[model samples]
Target: MARGLIKAKMLPEGKEVEFEVEKPVKVSDLLKMAGLSSETAVVIRDGTPLLETDVVKPGERVEIVRVLSGGAKV
Candidate 1:
């Protein structure tokens, strides 16, 4: 089976993660492969927000971000 390699970068932290898996996999699967929390992470494929079921193609650059939480620091 063909496979795709993707790299994920964490914003504000500059952390990079690499993932390798079969091609035509869902974004959700990529998240899992990258060891990220699906609920807290927002995914973007090729500069576009992607759905969980969205198919990830080879050589496609993907980004993953963790939702920030902070308001009126107390």
Candidate 2:
């Protein structure tokens, strides 16, 4: 199994958390493993947005940003 790192924005606290992951898995799988919902965040690798079906490689660092929508009227 390969190893990788994931930086995700945690909810409630909105803090960025770093966690390790075993690669050869899809981005969606990784999110599931991390207890994160795919609908809540997006996966980015090497400054590029990756699809849920995209495979993450070992030693790769991915960022998970929370998807925020809706804003107060100005």
Candidate 3:
């Protein structure tokens, strides 16, 4: 991990990316920085799903999982 950067790993693809966070940043904003939508993907930290409003700090680690919809018709 780079010094003073938020590290996040993308699920399925297992691609790792880093973001420079000078201050606390919202999960949704991080998702946007990764070119993803909160509705389409979820941010996870320490194996816990985080809310869009949840704040992530610099030097923190997270994972982004793409949500797949359209399973058995309800």
Candidate 4:
């Protein structure tokens, strides 16, 4: 069997990245691989949000959105 790469589109930057995974891994783990913090980012697939514990298999496409916080003091 051959391994497939995981494709992820990083938000804000709108850049696509790819990586290989021998087996299914947690969304959080993937974030770490992309140098993203789970606390500030989220994994979404098929237009749905995925939990940190959600399993991400190889050859799957996912979107990583970085949640930003800002407010105008009025």
Candidate 5:
């Protein structure tokens, strides 16, 4: 089984966390393992947006970030 590192910026606290997991795991799975919510975060692989069903390959760096909402009322 292939393995790689996944790093993410957790919301609320805004702290970064890193972990290693087997390759081919869904983005959802990565979120679960990283202790993040799938609804609030976006997964990116090698600077490309990856779907939850996308498989992460070995040696690939993944960044899961929480989407921030902000707006100015007109």
Candidate 6:
């Protein structure tokens, strides 16, 4: 089986992490490989948001932004 590379840019730290996949995998799978939870992080490619069911192609770069939900109740 061939291996594919998925480059991810993590938020807050603005660090880049790379993961290897056997082939094109779903966003959920990619997250699993990266050890990130779907509820806390969102996957984006080409400035567009990707769903859990969306497929991430080989050698693609995506950003993983952590969801921030904090506001004044006022």
Best prediction by TM-score: 4
**Span of 10 residues, lowest total lDDT, candidate 5:** 5-14
Candidate 6: stretches off by over 4 Å: 69-74
lDDT score for candidate 2 against the true structure: 0.73
lDDT of 3 at 12: 66
For model 3, what is the C-alpha lDDT against the true structure?
A: 0.89
RMSD of 5: 3.5
Per-residue lDDT tens digits for candidate 2, residues 15-68, read 777667665778888788767789887778767888999987655666776677
Q: Which one wins by lDDT: 1 or 4?
A: 4
Task: Evaluate residue 24 in candidate 6 and report its C-alpha lDDT on the 0 to 100 scale.
Answer: 91
The deviation in Å at residue 63 for candidate 4 is: 0.3
On the 0 to 100 scale, the lDDT of residue 32 in model 3 is: 94
lDDT of 4 at 64: 92
Write down the worst ten-residue block by lDDT for model 3: 1-10
| Candidate 2 vs. true structure, TM-score | 0.63
> What lDDT score belongs to each candidate, Candidate 1 first?
0.74, 0.73, 0.89, 0.91, 0.72, 0.87
Question: For residues 1-74, could you state the per-residue lDDT of candidate 6 as single tens digits?
Answer: 37878899987569999987888999998888878899988999999999999998878899988777577777
Model 4, span 1-74: residue lDDT tens: 35788999999789999989888889989999989899999999999999999998998999999888566768
Of 3 and 6, which scores higher on TM-score?
3
As a TM-score, model 3 comes out at: 0.84
Better of 2 and 4 by TM-score: 4
Candidate 5 wrong stretches, greater than 4 Å: 7-16, 70-74
Could you tell which candidate, 1 or 4, scores higher by TM-score? 4
TM-score for all models, in order of appearance = 0.73, 0.63, 0.84, 0.87, 0.64, 0.82
Task: List where candidate 1 sits over 4 angstroms from the true fold.
Answer: 71-74
Clashes of each: 0, 0, 0, 0, 0, 0
Positional deviation of 8 in candidate 3, in angstroms? 0.5
Per-residue lDDT tens digits for candidate 3, residues 1-74, read 23368999998689999998778889999999889999899999999999999999888899989887657877
The TM-score between candidate 1 and the true structure equals: 0.73
